[model samples]
Target: MKLIEALPIVLSCQNLSKSFRGRHKQETVVLADINLEIRKGSFVTILGQSGGGKSTLLKLLGGFLPPSSGNVLFNGQSLKNNTPDIGMIFQDHNLYPWMTVEQNVGFGFRIKGEKPGNYKHLVHEILDTVGLSHARKLYPHQLSGGMRQRVAIARSIVVKPTVLLLDEPFSALDVQLRRRLQEFLLALWSEMNTTMILVTHNVEEAILLGQKLVVVGSNPGRIVEEMTISDIQYRDRYHPDFLHVQRYLESVLEGNLKEQGDNYYEEVLAISRIQKINS
Candidate 1:
């Protein structure tokens, strides 16, 4: 077994489902029977299109939204509500416009009634790690989109959350900036070893960052496919194997490859072999 597979399960959901009551008491099922297990210190990416309940699944996992049925387990305990141990970052930076970078990153400590002297060093440390130490005095309006996002991330990680749930946090940035942030996030995860689950509609981003990728299908979102990718080749966007898998996943998301089961793996492995021979 892979080392990541051997790690203890840090978070999981059992038969998790969520529904909302709409007008005339109509029930709209956003998610159904989502059973997932995240390993300790692993990076898991959830891929799906918009309105596919990807965000809802993330919220349910984080206890930001309660599941209509089933349970979210954290460290083997059923999660009743959002806990500090699980931090969340959304697509929007959602920074405090009035607070400077330093103040904003330190807000988590302040909200917990911690004194400045208690968390000041921690706030500085995280800011430096995120490459925002020099921008500590800048307010939200003064920072660039990427910088604001970095501050938001710093804010979440400064508290040392065991798991971080991100909801398309880089979707708004330009392609170049998005890639940079993806690398930044991966580096931070490596350093912190925090189990990270990020939900995104971007296929390349999902494969690039995830050790495990779970694809959620729409029409009451469900896991259509789950893949464990360990090969470093998958990390290269231009690699033949990487492109093959990306195209296959794209087809799956577009509802074209539903019946392609074992053939998918065979094709990907075949491509890997071809590349190895050519190299």
Candidate 2:
């Protein structure tokens, strides 16, 4: 076991629920009565079906969205709005087309009106950590999908946020690329030791990246399963225990409601208030 119980609780949710008025003014419930506690410097994965409020929950946790009922606390304080202490990354890179790699990575500081002299060292350091120092001069259009995501990850961490909420940042890549980025993410997590919550529909990725796997069920989405992966040997994809866990999680996801409907997503996005690539 990792003895996470002894660690400080970096983030927590209590009786959380999110809903929004539907087209006809009916409240469409997405997530409800969800309580969670994440230890500091831990990697947690939130897994569920598509449109199952995974992204919505991530938004709530990151303070990117307000919950309908409950509260999200970071280091024991309620999150009212977005804070620099919590960084969010969407599936798309969301890098500026006009900005070069170094510029994009340095943007967190730039947004705060910090001079390049202040953030130059930090940006270059993170870019090199993600193996993108060579691409610092390249534009977003010039990078591959995996490279783009790497930049997004780099951008989020460059600020040294206490928590990094990732919303399927690796889902868009090819299988091979996805695997590579997964490895890269794990390495980043190891180096930074930041509290991370990754929302993904991929079972294998969830098991691989998370020390604790949270399986959320749909239809008024709630966490239905929580598993702690204590053994370090299970990190191997080819390990029998890893394969067994993957199969079990696949079965769990297969049993959930296949869809959350247009109303669900429509209401979700409206309430979540999350920003994406095009935006």
Best by lDDT: 1
Q: Candidate 2 — which residues are off by over 4 angstroms?
A: 256-279
lDDT agreement with native, every candidate: 0.88, 0.84
Pick out the ten consecutive residues of candidate 2 with the lowest summed lDDT.
270-279
RMSD of each: 3.6, 9.4
Q: How does candidate 1 score on lDDT?
A: 0.88
Error of 2 at 143 (Å): 1.4
Residue 142 CA error for candidate 1 (Å)? 1.4
| Tens-digit lDDT string for candidate 2 (179-241) | 888888888787776888999988989988887789999998999877777466558889876
Q: Across residues 139-237, which tens digit of lDDT does each residue of candidate 1 receive?
A: 999988889889999999999899999988998799999998898998888888799999988999998998788999998999988777767787799
Cα lDDT for residue 2, candidate 2: 44
Q: TM-score winner among the candidates?
A: 1
Model 2's TM-score against the true structure: 0.88
